[model samples]
Target: MVDCPHLRSIAPMKTSYLALFYRSWPRLASKALQATTANLPNSFAIGLFCVAALCAAPVPLKAQDQDPFYYEIRPLFENGEQLGQVYRFRNVGLIQCLNGDLLAFVEARHDVSDHSEKDVLMRRSKDRGTTWGPYEAVWGHLEEDHAGWKDPAPVVDKATGRLFYFMNTNESEKRLFYMTSDDSGYTWSDPIRIPDSLLRPEWKRWRNNPGPAIQLKVGKYKHRMLIPGHIVTHEDRHFSVVWYSDDHGESWQVSETAVQGSDEVSIIELSDGRVLMNIRSHGELDPGLDPAYRNFMYSDNGGESWYGLETKRDLPWESGHGSLAKMELGDGNLLFAIHPLVVKRKDLTCFVSYDEGKTWPYKKLLHEIGGYSSTIVLDNYDIAMSHNHGFRGEHGIDFVRFNLSWLTDGKEHANPTVQPLPQAPESKATDRAIWREDFELADRTILDGGSTAWKILGASNAPIGAAVSNGKFRTSDAGGEIVWQTGRIDIGDAKRISIAVDAIKIGKFNNSDSLRIYYRLGDGDEKLIESLSFSSDPQEDFETYRIRKHDINVSGNQQAQVIIRSRINGDDKTLYWDRVEVARAE
Candidate 1:
């Protein structure tokens, strides 16, 4: 522990109503007046107000409770990066102990270029969010290779009062590994790996970047805590597989996909026991089209499953990233701070997720920024997020809380009501548990901002290669070992167009392959669009990520029954997907 000298004092409760207004005076005004007044004794009553007004009169703020939602980023380190020098990077988990010391678990990323190795870094904030201590390395790896640890998830078990860290094994395709700190982060425990027969080497390689993010923090006011993290990557495709632990880090299991194409996952619990999970998807490829952006998920049953949370019950994320938080507001409205980004341009946009991530209609474009961000709700309830300032280059993280009024430049009712979900077949994909279910949504979405309609088939618990696999598409069982097949879906339209495909590789392989998106339009020509490229990258494990693509585009609307086929030349693997969103553009 270190010595500290920061002090904050608030006035004792006032029994009289007008006294409340006097206590709420602006700090500067209160300080100036206190020197002259508040010293004299009998400035006593509201009726004696004139005696108090003998020197100066007091004013009151009307409708203070109805104040608009706002937040100003506060740095945890007084000698922060800019302030001076203290803990550099602050990851997801931020916890305050009973003894009055605060702590944060940060992905000690000295390099944010998607190039260097990342590890778990730490800092102690003794004075709440005001300042931090000297930096400490919880899991820093000296070697700069993909084999180093990344994303460290820390949790202080309420049951054990013990601090446990669930991080990834040393390799990119590593399994879950953990360690414990008994002496309140001042000590040690060798990393221990958790084994589940369901883990597949190839699949592990596919999700090599383990965030190991999040450390369970004390809830606003509850016994239950939450532990969360994300499977990360630098690859073009944005995919996030979030995992959560209810009782600290005793054990871990798969949570849900915060967003299909998310990378960083962080969870924060509100005072009301509401758990909000934010996943940063890649908006770099396409904000609306690409999944990278800030996306959200909520869990009412703690962490069982978020497929039914009320968060998106109102606003389904079209896309965006980082995380969100709720604050004790002047008005009854809660405050949220998020670092937003657009996938295609790598542009940044900041906004507010007001109603438990249900909708962010109250948004202000806080610049086109990108990078990891996690916010906190201090005792006074100031909300802020830390992230790289630029949208294109590598920049160290910084935090600041700005208001919604600042973001929208005072705009009103920003998030307009969207088009009502079109009436269609109620989705049957998520209804089952043990097995997978696949149902195609009959309606066509106007994607890429236009005309062509791409059919989408969403699946849940559905085994990919296990049910049907060709050289192109595959699915596996829990172990990611099962492989099945359905050769190809042949289309009939061939005349005024052509057929083509890229490639698909659920798990890595030695083969260079491609799979074409094949289809037959209504009473028209058979066509195929091949644009996927399967990778030929060398693998440290049994898998590889290949980019394969067929070079063809078919006539509009003539595309029928989209199908993918591939020839790996030697190995056999099943390709799987939670859902298939087919966009057959013109």
Candidate 2:
């Protein structure tokens, strides 16, 4: 187990440089005067006096003082490690048992990718996330198994203290299976497939994915066990629902579909007995629809039905899995964790909502580069989070431990300063130029697919394909058909728009490898303006790609948007972009 040291408060150091200078200057000056009066060399005395004056300057502030929030981040599972037969871990699930022990479950993948043959692995932290035990294969085989066990959702029945663990099998007959542990997760019963009576006939053909589960403690559904989940009907149509059991773990029933065009749902019961479901929008799966945003809904009939699909404008997260849990503190505070970006999956952030799930005012960044996070409120009011990341170039699962005070302390763990992108030469004196981004600086707070000045509109789930890395905007084939667009930019009295970009392909290109650029004019859909396909031999160097004004037809629209997308077929291949300039016709 790799341990991340806790951040300690640093005391300001006191140095008397001014006093030393004051005492040394007088003696040095007196010695210089005596040397001059005694007809001896005074050059050495003068140099000593100059050195004392330089030493009197005040010391600069320490690096720790500039940014002081250092929460604990530890590694639980990483890539290339011999943790049983698995090489990677994904889809994390964490819960604190009635016995005050932390049970963390993850999908142990045979490969780094998502669809690899997988198993459900477990680790227990008896001391509240400070330490963890060895990896135990709870489900799937110790050797390679053709069937995959995915998406572990654990919920403990407070009334009976029985823990239920639910997961799905990736076999030909994708079915939901669950096990129970009476002794607080030390052991689990045999895997039992969910009864056919609980599932809708339409859902049998659809792909189902499970998220975190919660045991309701309020109103008419006091002891109901609700597991939030979703089913993908097609590439463009998916919705969220809940599977509930009122009789402990004996029988379960599926709820009505809540939000359409969404995936990976998490639910938290509000004070008024309404369950709030947060869904990740799947706009990227359908090009006819706009880019996705964080969406939400509410169910009042004890998780059986839902309504009100509202977009959360403030939370702006990428299209990835997030976790939500209600704090045990009787104040009705809710804890949420996500990638907190519109385009890229970086900066895993934890948010606290004091007024139920209405608003989130406090947040803390847990990991710089994170994906698919699971959060659980501990028995002692602290938070234990398990997430996916490649720390120090090794990808795996990591756990973070923090509290409410650490989250709301207003200090940041990563770089707090936003670096300005370099200005383009064409934009220096042009009044018609609306927006430009060179991505010269690093700012974690800036939304993914966007800088401080422009908002990037794209699929937040495509992290491997689109990101700002190594001082350049990079798009890789690993991200798979990535498309990113900017918000509308006003064009003032410009007949035509021109853009210049520097791009490069990191590896050999295939037949379908190409970079396509498009623009959307005033309430119109995106229209292709230029498509650059690589037909030449493999080129591993950067090349300038320019879009002339005559190549595009703006149709006299006052506002327009530019879209950049990559269609490549290869592995470990990247396309780097820099020095992007947009200007009016000269």
Which lDDT tens digits does candidate 2 get at residues 216-258?
A: 8789998898987776553446767778899987788888886
Q: What TM-score would each prediction reach against the true structure?
A: 0.45, 0.56
How far in Å is the alpha carbon of 200 misplaced in model 2? 2.9
Best by TM-score: 2
Compute the lDDT for candidate 2.
0.63
Writing each residue's lDDT as its tens digit, candidate 1 over 1-586 gives: 1111211011111211233233344443545555655556654433345444543443421222212433333333222343222323423455444344556665554344333455566677654444568666665432212334544455455445566666553345445656676556776454555544434332343232222233333443243544454443444444445454554455556644444455555666654565666654553432332342344666655554554322232222333345555544434445454554354324334445555455665443333454445555443333344544444223444444443333343342222221121122333332222111132222211111123222223233333222322111343332322212112223334323323222224345443444434454445554444434555544322222222223234444333344434433333433332222233222
Q: After superposition, how far is residue 203 of candidate 2 from its true place, in Å?
A: 3.2
